[model samples]
Target: MASFATRHIARGTTIRASDCGSLADRGSSLKVEALLGATDQQLRTSGIDYTITAPSFFMQNFISFFTDDYKSGTIYQPVGEEKIGWVDVRDIAAVNAEVLLNPGRYKGRELTITGGESLSYTEAIAIMNERLGATTQFVSITDEAAVEAVSAAQFPEFIIDVMISLNHSIRQGHAEKTTNTVQEVTGRPPITFRQFVDDHRTTWL
Candidate 1:
């Protein structure tokens, strides 16, 4: 029997056997969440062995979203002091590879992949500053301003709303939990944010 493994952005909450039911409930308000919930439902009933890898925030966001601001010596975000478990995409891929190679071992499993540590943006930026020897600062912006900034960037209205909702969820402390799914699945510890920064130090410079 062939097995399939799929990855989805879990926003903040980790998906376990117990949390699958809530995906549909959360989908009621968010379009992206609803689509993911529907996909999960289909996979569960497909009768084919499937594994879902639900991952938290990606640590690469600093490279994509905060790089320009970091270059300016400041990074602004709407999540004030909320800590997030930011997983490396490479680690997520490792878990996916492991499940794909040994499908029977992980059948019907929903693994929540996350970083080894939970850190707020401020705390993370501090780590970056120390690691890269840069003095970039983290500034918290209001939700309204965040929306305006994205809107100004001409992001689609639907995407802007979804991002705002996800930020709200993070602000409520939904993404703060760390998981050992990476180590459990891949036999290696997930990359830490500090190490991620150190590895990508040239990007900031």
Candidate 2:
């Protein structure tokens, strides 16, 4: 485990995974901290610097994990009417690169990064349908059914539980907030969800 290995690390900065602000944020953060807490503590004990990055749901999820469902113009989830601050992964990388290159500058900092706009799945799919000219749909499901569906695939219980909690959090409006950390840290506006969809139109086509 990466967490266990943190104990052996004598120097160098660490980047911890945190969550965007929302109702569904706390449960996952606790689970992540359990895995990474040892590393966090070890880094502190050794006087090594560390920073945490809290990013919202990634814009690339549709292309990466949900392509099969997207092919049928469907984005299935339990996220109800809540707007999500969908983040572009590229900007996450840029911030990480900046921190990695100049670790001392961002020492002990925890940044909540986002793509700068919040939109529900319905709005996002509409944008995709318009720009990509593909009639993508956001098909919301009940929390129990979504969890059961993932569980039926033989996923681990913990993974399924987390997925359910994440969806519940979104439905509760936890991930609806946006932040300027990306622009502030990288000195440029974070890519919008539309930009990400436009840039990757060929993937869906």
Candidate 3:
């Protein structure tokens, strides 16, 4: 069996039996590669036979993880000014299905899936607000304040750190590039941010 892993998980680390549950732990026989954002070097050293890399932040975060912030009309994060290529979860799912079904075809390849455009939080919020007919705003917070807010919300410290780092990565332009891997793999263009917001309008409302 094969399993997915994140880019943050160190290379050569044993697949934890408790990670995604027992079915995910196939011991030495389990195939792991990019999973989420694993670098080429990390995939090469992961000891997995088939490797597929997906690099991009998901646009679904606004609905799932940041719903409260979005609904409350203020998105609090540390990503300032930099633009990010936020791919839709549907597109990512399609690409993952294709890679899993055609393992040999996607093996040893890094698929940098992204939306049709790169947008900063400000730009993305505008699109979403316009699409939803709401007036949500994006507020840029400092890293320390973000961490403190997360902590006050009862999130684990490690996860708080990850959240801060993720915002830092975005603020530094780490996800500014857009790719057509989703179209190439799924045989269709990825959903744009506006399109995504439109499709999930009810959720945002």
Candidate 4:
């Protein structure tokens, strides 16, 4: 699906494809990750000017995936004590905009963007608890349990599988690396999880 769209979009104009930072190592065996890697390969060999903005785990997951869990005072996930460089979607968007505005400058370059810091779920929840004045806990669950939880929430099977695989990667410390790509590209530091929690305090409140 993504590769098909990219093939058509790369015909005339410059193209920018969003991908996962895991592609940096070229070691991911996950289904979605492999698919993205293949698409990136196509873009690189197509002889077209393209920019790939590969971002780490999104910070907005707190609002979208973990909101209900946070409301219940627990963040349940398969990732144990592993730290992840959770980049804000807004920062990723800024990078995309910068690349789009200066296509020639970033031609054929792939930028892996991440937050300024890598933090475990426990550390992130601590920040949120301190900022939002709420007591939220991080509970490590088995991959099977995580899948069951998402399934009970009515998430599609593919998404549930992807979530579990990503969590597994995080456990292996694949998402723990931080980079200056966000600041280097946008002329500003990537938003920290602390700042993100502060800005979205109302979501938890």
- Measured by lDDT, the strongest candidate is 1
- lDDT, candidate 2, 16-66, per-residue tens: 233436221222354433344455455555655566666778899878877
Q: All models: lDDT?
A: 0.77, 0.71, 0.67, 0.76
Q: lDDT per residue, candidate 4, 83-147, as tens digits?
A: 88889989988888888778878876767778999899999999999888888899898988877
Which of 1 and 2 is ahead in lDDT? 1
How do the candidates rank by TM-score, highest first?
Answer: 4, 1, 2, 3
How well is each residue in 39-143 modelled by candidate 3, as lDDT tens digits? 444556776755444446788988888788888989988888888888887887787787777777765665566788999989999998888888988888888
Which residue runs does candidate 4 get wrong by more than 4 Å? 1-27
- Total clashing pairs in model 2: 2
Q: What is the lDDT of residue 61 in candidate 4?
A: 94
Q: What is the lDDT of residue 51 in candidate 3?
A: 46
TM-score of 2: 0.80
Worst 10 residues of 1 by lDDT: 16-25
Candidate 1: where is the Cα deviation over 4 Å? Answer: 1-31
Spell out the clash pairs found in candidate 1.
Answer: none
